[model samples]
Target: MQEPIQNRKIIHVDMDAFYASVEQMDNPELRGKPVAVGGGENRGVVSAASYEARKFGVRSAISGYLAKKNCPDLIFVRPRFERYREISAKIHKIFYDYTDLVEPLSLDEAYLDVTVNKKGNPSATLIAQEIRKRIFDEVGLTASAGISMNKFVAKVASDFNKPNGQKTVNPDEIIDFLEVLPIRKFYGVGKVTTDKMYHLGIFTGKDLKEKSLEFLVKHFGKSGAFYYNVVRGIHNSAVKSERIAKSVGAEHTFDENLTSEVFMMERLESIAATLERRLKKHKIAGKTVTLKIKYSDFTVQTRSKTLIYFIADKSLILDTAKELLYQEKMKDSVRLLGLSLGNLNTEVKKTIVVQLKFDF
Candidate 1:
């Protein structure tokens, strides 16, 4: 008897060293050479490194000075965000043609839920291959893809293959694939978390599965629940398009939480500045401003106000946040302060042409 295939189908598409690859694609002379995208001076950091540069230990977020030391002849170029964004939109449109269930992780990577696709294709592997081919042919760039029953496996499978490659993980092969996987390869397991896992003799997914939930939680706090689910290849998060903005804000947990109001207000001002910049960048306006306070004991509370009109002004946001902060009846000393801009109007503008098309 033949086993029925599951209806769930997912695809993970990721560009290869996106910024550096885009530059190399535009300039034929840069191909097969060490190239980096970022400022080249003393203080600048490397944003992306070519595969050639990767051989010399150069990587993104590493200081430009260190990157040059790693690869002496590495060519550095400034990022072209506008150009990248234009290309990203085109890539997203291509995914929409296949399926509207697209979740973009960044400008370079996205996840597609193709269980019910426009083409009614049963094979996800073939869909991935076709998408990759279209990207290469139309966009003049290469991409790697992974096809699987779920997002986690699909993401892992995509990385298994290198630049310009595709891979698929069948349901039958899940256990075999996870048995030999390193603990560090798991998502959300950073260096600090990985070190703690190693100390507890958790070197692989199989080892992690052996630990009790209580034990994992004792060490990893809230994230331990996530680790428990991921090890068993279980995740329930859906591919949602209309993702509501849960507290549009900026916050930073200090290396050492301070109690001084002067320094706290200074931090709040910086956060407000950043939020205002992001608002302008996204061309978004909001009607509510919220102030969040987290005390040393981890207890948190928020104070918010609904304003008369949409606002994106820097000074107005900071002043409103400061007023909200003053109104908070504090029961304990503060550890973290955050500012959020909410009630955003993100509705798409309906053009006359678009309306005519809709009428037709």
Candidate 2:
């Protein structure tokens, strides 16, 4: 059976062609014309392309040479990241005006938990409209908004109406909305995963929902549960407020106790590699390594060492973890081992800005 919808209100706001729009706004001559940020005389890639340029198949991450071929008159402008950040900060201020439960996905996109907003407005849809209006009026940038009961649906709905538009997925319509959603449109379903889904006869959310949890887990590993829940319109992940991350780490429990140091080293290596990827994805480096060891007897021991400099490389993590591992003497059979990197960079999260309310 499906769960009842939580009374949370989420709004995902995405600036339409943020960089390209900023360029057009700053220069009157570029308005309503095909424009892109990044890719000038030098051999570079396009970071952001305007809707006009997109019509000619111009897109971000494509070579400048190819972009020109796609649209002969496509204008390339180098990115001014500092300027973008300045404007992004101004836009963020607007978000803060409404609620503190604002989770910025990027400079151009954010998820707002307006459940307990400062304005005391119970309608997340109205809050979204006001935010979009303020973005256009104060920041001179058009944004698209999506409103729903949770982050996943809200984010997906945001894209349905692009370029200064908004869409709301009411609680009663969420199931219907998700049923028709393409697998590719779901969060974290990249091209590879989508192709895998296609191979498994999961073309849409409905197809995905029909699969057993065991089948999904067998096919997609850890993320299988994520897919299963999301297909049912049941994602419960909350927006997080800004905070400094204390560590980067991953750990796993063994089906059986392991006695061999060699086997334990192998597991640490795998754990270290996973941690490195997480650090890189978050663009963070840490200065401390901690090795957690759990014995079959229910005893847990941790060994940690602070490094001279921040490191996020697999080799560094593995080496540090290995040192921490070998430095300590083993006492009993091992049931679990975890590796963590401490002293990390800044991170952000939060939820329920309007305290997750709606109009009666």
Candidate 3:
């Protein structure tokens, strides 16, 4: 039998509208105004939206056109990922100063296991407050923090307060805190699952807790067990401090559908250059290259090629992606093109040889 992990302290820290907040922080004129970060409005998607813009129903992954339609006064800024990464490094350094058990979810979010920390602090809430303050002082950005006994509750609590705030769900308050939480508020429950839950009359953590394991498994398959434990605040997933990156990729969405092989290849070359930059920055290489193509009609296809040796060269990545692209029988004009390098060298190295079909 596995040992139960009890009395653990976890803190989830998430930057508030990281990109948009950075923009406002750097530009005095943009403060307290609606702003969004993305590419061209004609053919781009919103990467992040400010709290002001969010009031007008603007959100990330929505088209820039739709964002502007929703909030006509919204200001759009292009993403500066390199600058964001620089700040992320600073924040991560602060996290390491406290504890080595930090698991980064993205550039803006991370989980820290601080039950026994470098500072010898006993109160996780105080540590969270100090970390948030340091991030604001050093990075000129606000961060929200959640303090709980596990990753699940900590992550959810971090979102309880917006932009610059913190929330703590202590051991004694865990059950009451979760019982009234709407099913949609659960961290892993997306729109499809939320709709499915509604149909099953599962609207809150209490409703979820009432279902037997067998009933939940029958409805949700493998992930059912995860839901069962999470509802009762029994998440035991550890914060992995040294998580390996799975892949390096870059994508571009064109203003118009690309049909000519020459033009499409140009886009692929640029994407390959971006991917190469990312891989080199991280000092990692992969044996497999995947070509992602999204057609004009929204149909998507991924074709991949695996090499004998791990490669990080831009030319090699581009050429391999080109070969994979040309081999596929495209049904429509390509609207987006992306390249990814996976099957990293650090893990059990398998070539995963993909069969090349000239006409399929």
Candidate 4:
């Protein structure tokens, strides 16, 4: 039997418009103005946009041309990935300082298991407040935090407040919160699932919980099990830490398409350097190097090389990337390039491997 979820304490922290916030923090001119990070031309996409720009319906991944059409006053600028990475590192350090059981969903968001934290803190709410304050004071950025008894609820609570805010949902309030929340707010419920739920009259968590697990499974496949459990506030997933990274990669979309090998090599060197830094930071090495290329026409392809031993050196990474890049014949000018290191080392446990089994 498992313990009830009323005892757990989890927190989800999400940085508000991460890239755009960083831009605003670095340049006072961008503050309180409509700003976006990406290309200004028709061909580019918005990587991140300020809340001011979002009001005009600008969004990340939307084409720069479309963004301009939505908000003519939107200011577009290229992404500063190096700076973002630096800020991410600082925020990550803060999370670790609270609890080692921090699972990063991205550079800007993370789920933390604070049931038993390092600071000897009794209340998860206080810890969240401290984290939010530290991020603003130390990193010059604002973040929203959510505190709950489980990961699912914590994530949802975090978004209840907008930029530079924190929200806590105590165990007693969980039921009421879930009852009123739309079904679409469930973590794994994307467009397709939400549509399916709508067809089934499952518009809210209460509606979802009314259905049988068998009935949900019959219609929704494997994810139906997740829906059944989540609606009832029964999630057993722990904050996992020892997940082996399958690959380490760095990519950049060029401001202008480059057909010259010399320019491509220069970009590759930078990517390799970034990858090497990440690998070292994680104390990881890889034996395989993969290069990804995107053409101006939007077609993409990848080439990879495998080595005998794990390597994390900058020179080795760049060499492999260069070799992989030239190995493929160019079909068009390249618009984006990426490099990745993979095939990490895994620990072997003799006792686990030697487990005895008896057939009945």
Candidate 5:
């Protein structure tokens, strides 16, 4: 028989509007104002938005045109990735002071397993508090945290309090907390899923919990079981400290859709150059090159080619991408072009390690 899961101390730390915040921190004139990173009035999408900008319905992934329409005063700034990485390194250093078992979600968010922390702190709540305080004091940035028994709940709870706040879902409160949670609040639920759930009258965790595993599977297919288990607080995923990149890629969306195959080849060449730079940065190569195409109508298509030996040169990548692009007839005018390298040479051999403890 399998053993039941024992309580584990998990903390999810997320920086508030990390990109926009970094811009504001470096430029005092941008502080307390609506700001956006990596967007323009005519082209591109908003990568991140300040809290002030969000008030006017401005958010990431929206078009720059829409962002500006929502918040006319929104100040758009170019993204400085090197500076963000510098601050990220400093913040990660702080995490190591508490625990070595940290799983980074992105440049601004991470999960820390503090059950066996360097600080010898048994209370994950207090540890989260201290970590947030340290980030603000040392890095001059605000962070939010969520403390729970597993990564799922902790990740969800972290968003309960925004900017610089922390929320702890105690063992005893986990049931009630999940039951009352809005279905849309579930970390994995997207806009489409939320709408599907709403149509089924599954507005909250309590409503979802009432459905049978079979019923969920019937409606949601493979994800039905996930909904059933998570509603009951049964997530068992561990925080993987060493996450690997499966592929390296770079893409660009053009302001004007190109109908000419010649134009697409020109765009592909530049994308290949960007991909080569990324591959060399990681000192990794791949045998498979995939081409991603987004049409003017918003449909996407991909073509891939694999080689016997790993390659990372722009010449080779561009050559393969060109072959794939011509391999088929495009359905419509192309709006975006991207290239990716996969089947990486950095693939690690998996070795199973026996678990001595299953507790968090």
Candidate 6:
């Protein structure tokens, strides 16, 4: 018989400073130094930063210019996605030795369900420890894990202990743990949502729990129901082995912000070609094309159009992006441009599986 959803065992494993760590591991000279991957002093963006660099507030998504400004000794290295994927596959193999229900969120993190694992381990905590050890032994990379009853709480706990550590939020402690958690630390609560929650006087999970579902729904729409359930330890999302891609996209941040439409159109051509290559690599096609415009002032605007048929060609993608670009007037000088294809040819049909949850 299947166990109740509440008794499920979930583990969230996250690699620390994955790209930068990989670079450091391969090149001994980079060890113990402030290293950043995929950026430089003059331009580009930092894709990842070593823990050493993070001490100085260097992080991903920030401009390389700012990263250097933060840590002058930070070393910049190019990204090697293929090597990362190879290491990721090896780490995943270690996960499968314990359980088949591995849901990878990215190349650096994944969620594993080990309630009824292949190793027949009864304690999820021990299983997480063994898995981390095996990953380090086999892949030469350190990973952190969070063990709990569900994916949401597990993912949050994984961040509690960083750089080769683990945290287990037992079933009984779930409520108290979440109640004390800052509202900003809750997964899915980004800057905009946090600001909205603060405006409503919701600073912690306890404050959020006090709000009625109707009040949250009135302010947050459908997400209010989500918050209502998760705060009460009611997230039942299962770990699926396969996840479908919703869109294929590519974006570029210019070295200099362009004010002219002609310059912007020229940039869009390259971005569309890059998007096309990604679509073809994944064999993905979509009927909807979206153009993302990021202004020099950091404001973002998007324009989208849908077609009767799907397309993956660069010409078609560029034409649609060009149309969307000219469809709107310039709000400010454009710093970044992005193009994405959605309404994909692929389908997403989720199958929920209730697991075997026996008392330990």
Number of the top-ranking candidate, with TM-score as the measure: 6
The pairs that clash in candidate 4 are: none
1-360 per-residue lDDT for model 5 (tens digits): 122245678899999999999999999999999999976756678999999999999899887888999888889999899999999999999999998788898999999888778887778888999999999999999999999887889999999999799899876688899999999999999999999999999999999999999999999999998888888888877777777778899999998999988999999899999999899998999999999999876678999999999999999998899899999898999988999999998856442222222222
Per-residue CA lDDT of model 1 for 288-334, tens digit only, reads 99988887666788899989998888799888887887785567777
For candidate 4, write residues 1-360 as lDDT tens digits: 344356667889999999999999999999999999998797788989999999999999778988999998898878999999999999999999988888788889998887777897878899999999999999999999998877888898898888888889887787788888899888888888899899989999899888998999999899888878776677756666554578889998888899988899999989888988998998989899999998887788999999999999999988888888779578999989998888987552221111112110
Return the candidate ranking by TM-score, descending: 6, 5, 3, 1, 2, 4
Better-scoring candidate (TM-score), 2 or 3: 3
Q: Distance (Å) between predicted and true CA of 229, model 4?
A: 1.0
lDDT of 6 by residue, 166-271 (tens): 9999888888999999999999999999999999999999999999999999999999988988888888888888878888899988889999999999999999
Tell me how far candidate 6 lies from the true structure as C-alpha RMSD in angstroms.
2.4
Model 4 TM-score, all chains together: 0.72
Question: Over the full model, what C-alpha lDDT does candidate 4 score relative to the true structure?
Answer: 0.85
Which of 2 and 6 is the better model by lDDT? 6
What would the TM-score be for candidate 2 when compared with the true structure?
0.72
In angstroms, give how far residue 48 of model 3 lies from its true place.
1.2
lDDT of 4 at 157: 85
- Runs of candidate 1 with Cα error greater than 4 angstroms are 1-6, 245-274, 280-313, 316-360
Which residue pairs show collisions in model 6?
none
lDDT of each: 0.80, 0.87, 0.88, 0.85, 0.88, 0.90
Off by over 4 Å in 2: 1-5, 40-42, 243-356
Look at candidate 5 and tell me the lDDT of residue 134.
95
Each candidate's number of clashing pairs is 0, 15, 0, 0, 0, 0
1-360: candidate 3 lDDT, tens digit per residue? 233345788899999999998889889899999999996366788999999999999999878888999999999999999988988999999999998888899999999988878897788899999999999888789999999888999999999997699999987788889889999999999999999999999999999999988989999998898898888888877788777778888998888999887899999999999999988888899999999999876677999998999999999998898899789577889989999999987663332211111110
